[model samples]
Target chain A: MSGGPAGDSAIVVSDLRKSYRGRPAVAGIDLVIPRGEVFSLLGPNGAGKTTTVEILEGHRRRDSGDVRVLGVDPALGRAAWKARIGIVLQRSDDLTQAGALTVRDWARAMAACFPNSRDPDEVIELVGLADRRNARAAHLSGGQRRRLDVALGIIGRPELLFLDEPTTGFDPEARRRFWDLIADLARSGTTILLTTHYLEEAEHLADRVAVIVDGRIMEVGPPQTLGGRATAAATVRWLSPDGPRSVQTCTPAALVTDLAARFGQDVPGLAVERPSLEEVYLRMIGAPA
Target chain B: MNAAATLVRAPALLAVTRARARVEFLVFIREWISVVFTFIFPVLLLIILGSIFHGQRLPGDVDLAQYFVAGMIGAGLFGVSFQNVAIAIPIERDIGTLKRLAGTPMPRSAYFLGKMLMVAFVALAQNVLLLGIGSAFFGLDLPDTVGRWITYLWVIVLGIASCTMLGIAASGFVRNGRTAPAIMSPIAIVLQFISGVYFVFATLPNWMQTVAAIFPLKWIAQGMRSVFLPDGYQAQEPAGSWELDRVALVLAAWCVLAFLVAVRTFRWRARTDD
Candidate 1:
């Protein structure tokens, strides 16, 4: 009935646990997401990102422990909290059979869920779907379908949003556009929880990132420096008579300077780089070398 | 906010309910196949059956024209309340639409209430159409009292609620489109036959009369009969006591049990884990 409960934290889950019969999906996890920050939860398949999101969304019940979203216990949100949160599902719920309820109709429909929902056209524009506002939901291309999902998600003008694999089927350009839409929302002080298999999405959008594996949080930090990435080491690559070669070391700056001198000029095909977000993320998830 | 404050949020809830109602209505119109099946198909069945059995009186001297009127009326209500609700829901679930909505901040109860409201409206629409047919073709008499009208209205409502629950209950048990009809049709058809929607139960054998009495559909049809037919019709019919309150009470009980089953059995995910 109110906007949110009294608390500084946007979302707080303390030892939250949920099980399907006897097997735990979210096996005792504690998380505190600050308001107005874009946080990404990175995980592989069956790694509990969806279960945790579902629990936080109040769609599924937690068998034990305290879970709070937008300050109120989600288990007891009672539609007040639901009005302030938006969710962009991984799969499109395109009513191809339910004809011609256009973008405007959808926005109007979702707006009714909240007392103070956003204007439909503004939401359409926000999600880069203005051009297709009149088109039917089922007629949209895959990338455009993702945009519609974002449109419906933001139509409520939610304070917090949960995007589960939002750009999973997007092409490169659409993915970049979606990143901009998310960044714009973050700039407007809407806190977001993003879950994705695309490490690049996490690297690009997250203000803070958490790695989830085996139903556990393995690491949490900024994307650039997660999993000891900032100080873990760097790789220096250069063309060699023995073919292109590379070495990992802590002192990449010093190594690059030495390589510049040894090559007697700018090193041929030479590049000095820290590990990419994907590389670090893959390694953190324990993918094979 | 306190419970008092939540109660005061009625205006917002009304808006949400209205919006959902509009969407559902649009869905119905767009789903022309459902419209044809729910509305036109029943009308056709009535005409065909009426024509086939014309001139020859029912064994119990059952009014075939009035039977067509009553049965179609009940069938129309069942279509929206039980038939469409059951089928549309599973398809919606199989496609993950309900799970998608679960992610939104929409109150879970609002979803059902909105649906109930929508079905009630659609049933009203359906009843009026059938009422016109009944009056025009069968020399039907209007409800003798406002009380009878209210009684009939609520019976239709209860019938819908029971049907909706059956749909919801059935939706929980299946995960795909293939099994939806398989699960729904047999029970629905059986209810149609025994509940006096297609035939007056008095004409049936004694064993059937006893067996049909146990179901919600029987209560609904009996309740509707209490409204549409006069007291003399009951004496002639020789089936079902003319206890309007008893029928209402029986339906209300089934309604509560169905509501519980709907809530307890509801599954949002793709499949039953078991």
Candidate 2:
């Protein structure tokens, strides 16, 4: 609970618990995100990811435990504290009703809320929204609308940003572009905490990740090492003369070499496969294959 | 760091309020249907009803057109202040707009104040249009003396505050955007009838009169009538007098009560907190 200066870490939580009508949503969770790291919270639907993020964002009250964002306990975070953080909510169709105001106008208005903000047009360009700066928010396509959400979130030039399930409806190309935008933000030293159901997205962007299932953090690590994904037994397979043969082995290279020596030629359909991050995640969550 | 230093001393709350007000106003103006309904509908109703009953007289020798003009203005004020706020707030909540705003650095008071300012602006415009149409075409007298103008100002201010707060308080009952209009429209129509916006209060049943007297809409209508009607026309009122003191007292009390209720019950998110 005694994390140093709020400036040292973007977020710190300990023994956090929240319930909805006697149903536990986030139970005894603990986490710490250093400054400028991209931390992803990965969970299946109804796994308390949104609840945990909302609690950290100060949008929901916790039943018990300590929580801090930017050194201030979010429960007591006022406007001054709020100004230091940015939040792109799970679903925000705000300003769609204000169709007459262009994207730049919306950004300007949002920027005015913070103590220090990026130039509106610069933030728009950073989100790849400069071309449609004059377009009304209502007219933007779904992916474009999400980009605008990101633009608004970052316009405040916040020290920490929270993105809840961003890129949910994005196409493949749009999703990749969004990843780049987020990477650039991280490069510029803005701490990011993102929640997503997309495992590949978490793998691509997260410097560290926490997998939550049924209101608990089942595993926490870098994407490569999550759930021992890096060192898990590899499955070596080859098409033998009889049929396809496969074995799970600790040393896949030795298994492949023995198979090659026995074949005396290239092993047909030879393959050595380690479990993917998604597979490890699904197994950890106890999902039915 | 320099930017933060500069903004640390700036009136950041006021800036947030101004920005929110600007956004609210922009959204309001873009809703052309709302604009026509809130501002033009009242004047149109007055003109049509006034022309049809130009020379008609009510039970107490009150001219029907003149009285109707006053009533429509009152209704218009209620429409822009109370009905609009109540309906719009729930819609914002349903759309997650309020939830998003709640996460921002904008103070909650600044957000509500911004909405109130927009409502006040539209209410004032509706009043000006109604008064203009009434004076120019229906032979209604404008408040000429400073005292009458003062009364007009206080009545309008207090009316808008009370009605708008009540509207915000009522928004809590609307579960989502789709049901907001359905729930609010029927209630507004019923209040209009009971408050004598469309009919004579004295002619109504005693129970209906009592029901209307409990609400602020009735007092707002009575206050407007006091300002616009001749001194003798006060006899037509249910109280048999302008009762300006009671009007002020009732409206002020409602304003305070509604403000407290709204602040207590307001929800930034569509769903329950738990």
Candidate 3:
């Protein structure tokens, strides 16, 4: 609201740093996310994903570095600037204050705060909460409560949305539904910054993904090609007369042909497998991979 | 220019306050603990105390029941405005409700205004309940003159303003929801006792009376007594007169002082957050 909007990018950070006491949380990080992009900050717990997002959301202040979210420094975000962005904080069992308001009622109240907001009912339906419209927030399941959170976030029709581990406790079915809702929002051209530890989730929803570990960005690229997954060596395995044999090679096709030639026919129990995103992410984080 | 700025914000501010008041009222009604403590407990005490001290007369020939009716009104105002705001807000902070609202574009003033609006409604209902019960069963007399009614109205208004601000300021000291009642209730109960809401002010020890004089509750209760007690009863007061000016002065001062403290101490995030 104070400065002109940054061109082309929704978020830009240069050496963004934050620390708690004497220890660093988001140690120096740099990122640039283009407008309308669904970018995910994927990392394990304590890896600075939430800290970085919270800084971007203006919920926390940075100790140092230049950061721009929607072209305004979040530290100086005012009401007019806040109205243009939406935030979905990490799930906590702190809805005791939600009281008896039904989902529709809550959505309508939140919508009233924004200057240009989507119709509450439409946003409810968009998040698949139409059937649970009249349920009090206390009565909704964890997934439904999260849907309400998301519904409230988008009710403002934010040009930029921050989803901090939006589907942490969701079951598989609920998570799939939540992902679809996010994909719909993205297709509508809303830029989404999601933080999650779920490899499949980032792969499913993010246009580009950044793998973070210990307050640093380990890799930033498309999930399919993260850590060179597209070009990484494939492992070829087969049951030979010696029992079992395997080879890690960039040319899996050539390896398979030679194995077939040795057997003079079909190779027994032969399998060629590329590293999944999970493996690549685990390896990037220095976890057991 | 200042008026123009207010004009631009007035509509949205009023709308948000009204919406918040509606939700706050619903939440207050649903929480039976808050309702019973704020509205029901003081009236119940008045009845129980009035009956126990039935037929007893104060120095001014004021019946014990009539004396308590005035005190309970002040006590009920404190319970509804001060205790509720102090304890409820910390719980909101503890549970992240305040944190969530901070990110919204809702004007901060609207939040406090919404709370005051809700408190006004609840305090009015509390007064009707206390007065209706007092007159119906305890033979308490209602004020008969317009002047007395005016005094009654200002006492209630000033009492609520001062207490609500103090409550907001006190909320900052609460660390979490679990510990809030433990910390808030003792302070509220102690203030009521020392302020002459629970006993004869003239009978209180010298140190206690001196201490009570420094707080708003004593002035609020004394103001209520001036409105309800018969004419010429001021001889029983420590000052031997209805010091209406001093009463108004003390309460208005507390409103300003507590407001500054509240603004300085209010925390939007829960303790767990950085």
Candidate 4:
């Protein structure tokens, strides 16, 4: 196999930092995203997620950092680099200026700016906006408007895509549909950098998840294994004669077997549970209260 | 992956500019308020003012209706090129449209070129409409000589270019769409009144005329007057002559100044961006 323009990595960052008015927004952080991977950055509102993403997108100037997106330093990104990357912003208010340009009109217009662009109609269908292709941007619902954004983002056939809290206002069904669309994009070999407050969204969509807090990264790993979640102690719970009884043990299977044998019959209401990704993530970010 | 194998050829610059202009024109025409203010208001004002001054005459035997016909054309040019762009761009910024484009591979020149095309088309159409109406009903004179026609062309081109650049520069001062009209409308209306668009130049107060002379609107209206009014009417001008040289100089100077100011002040993102 051959490496890309820079290397096997689609994105590389080291000692990334940014500040506003003498206050640090993104403290030192490091990350490397391999090509064709779906990477998610999970953090609280002020935890520097947007700052980090904007730096990588070249929408912002970082105070200090060595960051490469699609094998080019984003701070020095030009037309070529921009052509290779796509961006979906967080809100639909941005589309207010779209005015009377229909979905297909906007898509075709955006496609004209890119060197390697997908067919506008195909992209519209890919984002599930085919039915509303002729509708003006203002006439679309919030979720549909976002789909148009995604459609525009991918129309350039960008190798790397940045989605900033893309599903914030989406309903459950729309979010699920969006996740499927993202999954399809990932399967087609696009590298994705997603930031979201939804833990399940990260767990569902990301090949690797990084939890950031207080301008710093706390951990980075596959969602199921983050914070040692895969190996962490599991809790067993069942009904006892007096009340509910539970115990946390590393040997959960052994404990469950022992309880069943002592009970001498099917243990009523028996259940074993491992720490979910949300639980581990909250704990890593110190959000427990 | 090989760059050549995977990369598709981008659309040509001309094609992109055309696409952008198409979008801009659609947005401009669809916004009913802008259509009313930019296109309709000037024509209506001209008709009303021409009727009010129907039987009057200036010192050069120039009919008052004819005078206002030129004034309205000048005002219409300013409105379409300057006020339209000035207000539209800030609103785009406020709505994040400019930032969205910045992230794309579209060249900055193409974007501005698209804007210029849109403004030029609107200005041309507006000039024709105002002039046709002026000639048919208001008895305004059309330039009969080639020299006067040449002067007309240069003035319109310079006036549109300078005002468009100034509009782009002025957009930077507006914080958002809500404040755009409040800021842009007053400046435009005040300039019209003080620059002889609504009244004769020599009839205005001395201080107002002086203030108006320093701006481009005065020169634009003066240029239009020189084109549409007879050669002998130059005696009525504040300068006692057409001063075609000064008209070109002032408008050209403003075009250069506006370019500089826009380069320094134009912003791609709203002030609220992080």
lDDT on C-alpha atoms for all candidate structures: 0.75, 0.85, 0.86, 0.88
- Chain A (candidate 2) TM-score to true chain A: 0.93
> Model 3, stretches more than 4 Å misplaced?
A1-5, A237-247, A253-271, B1-11
Off by over 4 Å in 1: A1-8, A14-24, A63-66, A94-100, A237-249, A258-268, B4-11, B58-63, B104-107, B133-178, B222-232, B239-245, B260-274
True lDDT of residue A100, candidate 3 = 67
Q: Rank the candidates by lDDT, best first.
A: 4, 3, 2, 1
- Docking quality (DockQ) for each candidate: 0.37, 0.44, 0.40, 0.53
Off by over 4 Å in 2: A1-7, A95-101, A236-248, A252-272, B1-11, B58-62
Question: Chain B TM-score of model 2, please?
Answer: 0.92
Model 2 lDDT per residue over B1-274, tens place: 2557545723378888898889889888987877886667777788888898678787655677788788888888888888888888998897777887777777678887888899888888778888888888776788878998899999999998888889988988778877887888777779889998888777889999899888888888888888887878878777899888998999999888988888788899878644
Better-scoring candidate (lDDT), 1 or 3: 3
Question: Which is the better candidate, 2 or 4, if ranked by lDDT?
Answer: 4
Q: Which lDDT tens digits does candidate 4 get at residues A1-289?
A: 2234458888999999998988999999999888999999999898999889988988889988799887888888877778889999775465655577899888988888887688999999989999999998888887888889999989999999999999997899989988999999999999999999899899999999999998899998999899898889998999999899999999999988898899997998899998988888878888782
* Candidate 3 residue lDDT tens string, B155-273: 99998989999989988877887888888888889989999887988889999999999988888899988988987778988889879999999999999999999999988887657
Candidate 4 yields a Cα-based lDDT of: 0.88
Q: Candidate 2 or 3, higher lDDT? A: 3
Which has the better DockQ: candidate 3, or candidate 4? 4
Off-target runs (Cα >4 Å) in candidate 4 are A1-6, A239-244, A257-268, B1-11
A1-289 per-residue lDDT for model 3 (tens digits): 1133468889999898888887899989999998899999999999999899988988888999999988889988777777779999995454535566788878877776766778999998888889989888888988888989989888877889999999988899999989998999999999999999998899999999999988999999998899898888999999989898889999999999888899999999899888999888888899898
For model 4, residues B101-201, the per-residue Cα lDDT tens digits are 88988877778888888989988888888989899999988899999899999999999999999999999888788888889999999999999987899
